[model samples]
Target: MIESPGLLLTLLAFVLVIGPLVFVHEMGHYLAARWFGVKADAFSIGFGREIAGWTDRRGTRWKLGWMPLGGYVRFAGDMNAVSQPSAEWLALPEEERNQTFQAKPVWQRAIIVAAGPVVNFLLAMLILGGFAMAYGDTRTPPVVGTVLENSAAARAGLQPGDRIVRLGDRDIHVFEDMLSYTRIHPAEKTTVAFERNGQVQTLPVTIGVDQQTDRFGNNYRIGMLGIARGDRVTVPVSLFEAPVVAVRRTGEIVSMMVETIGQIITGRRSVKELGGPLSIAKVSGEQITLGADAFVFLIALVSINLGFINLLPVPMLDGGHLLFYAIEAVRRKPVGPEVQEWAFRGGLAAILGLMLLVTFNDLGNFGLWQSLASLIG
Candidate 1:
């Protein structure tokens, strides 16, 4: 028997990080359903066989599942966890049908479907706003303190005291902003604008690529520029201003996610960079070791990702449902059941394929293939 404390910690951290997010996401759907007089038949925090559960006064089955991956709310009139309407449900008694999810106005149904992702985004913003209020915000200027020998910055004629004002089309307000831009554009040539000696200068340089490995052996390839910031400063944000700061920070994170996806699609970044549940587990464990704040920050980051992903226009996702609702509104009718079924099938396959790809990447990152090969040899 092999017992590793790190493995245990990773498992524990994965549960801790994913549990609340899933609950919050499902709760959003549940609450919206309740608000619109739609009955939720079951509220689940996970999938597969139920470990433990209870029937609430409203007859909603609240349950915990064996798997801790994802969760859902099964509403009345819904055929499955994805909230697809059932033919039998539509034929129900008029009085009972009124309380079913499918009976709601298309606008109301759209809101119910959108609430999950919206709440996820809100949860992230709340956590980030709390951090901004408690610890203030970083306001370091984008001044170059040192130019490493033969670095991208050095090759671009960047020197100490040069203040980066822009990268490509993005305005760099701080050193961190510049870092964020460069990190996603690795090995890509881009124009940089900076101020030096009271004059603004612009030059094109190829961002360097750097491979980083965590203690858990997970690897990341990120963009790098061979320049260091001059100094760092944290300025206290007022309570009223904290929300603004949080919103801006959240937007920046989302922007980076979009940019990264664009890079991947454009073949500038490899698809191997995509991570799945295993990566989340490893990073959650590592963050917990760093401290509570670090772990909480990771939670917020993952929460944002969850929201962004669900908003994708892929079938079976919240965004896909919303897309259907939009079409219904425009056409004055819901999409045909046959079309929806086929779309859902395609969506499920795409999601499954993505899961497989990410899991393979995670295993590869952990050197599972090499270990198995060595043992076989």
Candidate 2:
């Protein structure tokens, strides 16, 4: 735990940011389960020894535990939640198990399992779009700030103070819009139109691909037309329409996540870009240092990540359970208990291995191991 201030920040970040996200995610599942009439025996916000608790009228134990990394909902007939096998529950006498999870319809079961992550995603998008509409977006004007010498833009006669009017036939208003359009369609030739001082002109510039290397020694080819980010402009939201901002933001986050997944598969993105607990802690600490807004934004971003990670089709996650439900929906029966047990074991191993690898990487990144080595020497 002892390291630089940055490391302290990272660890603190995990506790503050990740804890709430975990709470929100579990709450989603709990709410959905209740909606489906599944009787929850205990709802815990953390694990280990209980810190504070109270029983509800329905006999549900609502408690807060000492540890704060994650939480869980114990249903009436669940065998400790993480391993709630359907076959065992089905064997219970009909007179004894109306409120058991196994008795729920497939649709309800699927919804209850899937709701946790879905709510997190929705929360992220709403914050993004709502903030955008409320504060207006900070954007750069199309005006060029500085043209790098011998860079493609400079070589192609792009001058300082030139206001970019359009890319191809697409008229760009803000800096972000231009950046977004250029990133996806990295064309070799771009007919860029701009206004020089007061006069409009056009520059047909050849795009050059730049190679950048990762920490893992992987290389990525990034195309650039030699233009730099411009000065920002903030456009505020109008009256009576700021509420829909969050919805738009949610769509944008979903689009970004989808693109990230696609890029990783296509080798356009590096897998190393995916961080583990260490990364979360580091980002959490860094954002907290920047003040309240940045801190809140980091919290929401981490929440989105939590949701996305759980949604992956890996066997031990909520998504894995949903996958089983999906299979059940198709086959009109659950996969065998033996298969489920093996799948669970394999999935659990994969999760543990991944956690260990990411933790090692994080420690190295934070110089924890190296610092200890030096001290021992």
Candidate 3:
């Protein structure tokens, strides 16, 4: 059972983590709309009834919502928070129509829709770059300093002083690269290449799986190579190079996310590993306990994920709007309102279904279902 302090921390951490992200995301849209001279009717941090907020000089109804799940920017002449074009708003007089979102050219509308996710990516890059500049980067060579006795590396003929060159098809540049590759391929047979005394050799090794339980009793299964790294080097990155490092790191993270999703699609990974708001809250709390650095790192990771998820071509998402704009560009006319309405409905259903699945997974992870079963029994 969670203690009172821990529970409170989790709640606070969740708000701290999610609130800023939501605000940043919506602000991106609002800013882009304003740049195109589109009037904003409302700017909310969350959904549902307003908790507290004040209007800006531009007459935007900037308000806080009671439900803190997500947020939206309702542009003037929008039918709803999703920014669907209102028939009456579209039929406004020429002078007034100029300030509505739908009155803008297709390119402008697309930019406004795309800005939210782009800002999310930018936010992540900025945070990561700041860390790189402040703490420097770790540059540990992927040389095996020790091979654990009777472990997979030992059985595979790996020895001390072997400089790991590649794992399967992935080239191991640093120790962290090797670790990243191994962590995702637990219990799978993989090819390892290393150099010893100027001679390169390859061997097949089945990665060992290690099941670990965290302080919160959450279990994780990770792959282990049973080989340790040598000394590490920390290099200070220059201001000009920090952005390059941040972009590279962000790309690597996106690649990992893509690979994980591909694994799930191929049935190589379990869908039960999928998480929702509860899992995020738990993780946020745990990271807060670790330190501000750890918690901030979590924010960057989640920001990238939010950006990537929004880019998926699902209806009702930013990507979905872009997809519609793409179709409109090709046809030289907007998609039929009936078609858009149906597509959005379908999208909403898919999103709701996914939420239910993830929530169920979160409950199981928290042992809620198991505890209820035990109580009934």
Query: How far off is residue 202 in model 3, in Å?
Result: 2.9
Clashes of 1: 0
- Backbone clash pairs for candidate 1 read none
lDDT of each model, Cα atoms only?
A: 0.90, 0.75, 0.89
TM-score comparison, 2 vs 3, better candidate: 3
Which residue pairs in model 3 clash with each other? none
- Can you give the TM-score per candidate against the true fold? 0.94, 0.75, 0.94
Off by over 4 Å in 3: 1-5, 80-86
Put down candidate 1 lDDT per residue, 150-220, tens digits, no spaces: 89999999999999999998999988899899888889888999999999999999999899866645456
Q: For model 3, how does the per-residue alpha-carbon lDDT over 164-227 read when each residue is reduced to its tens digit?
A: 9999888999988999988888888989999999999999999988898776667899888999
lDDT of 2 by residue, 232-277 (tens): 6777875445546566555556566777678667886656565677
Question: Where does the lowest 10-residue lDDT sum fall in candidate 2?
Answer: 214-223
Pairwise lDDT winner, candidates 1 and 2: 1
TM-score of 3: 0.94
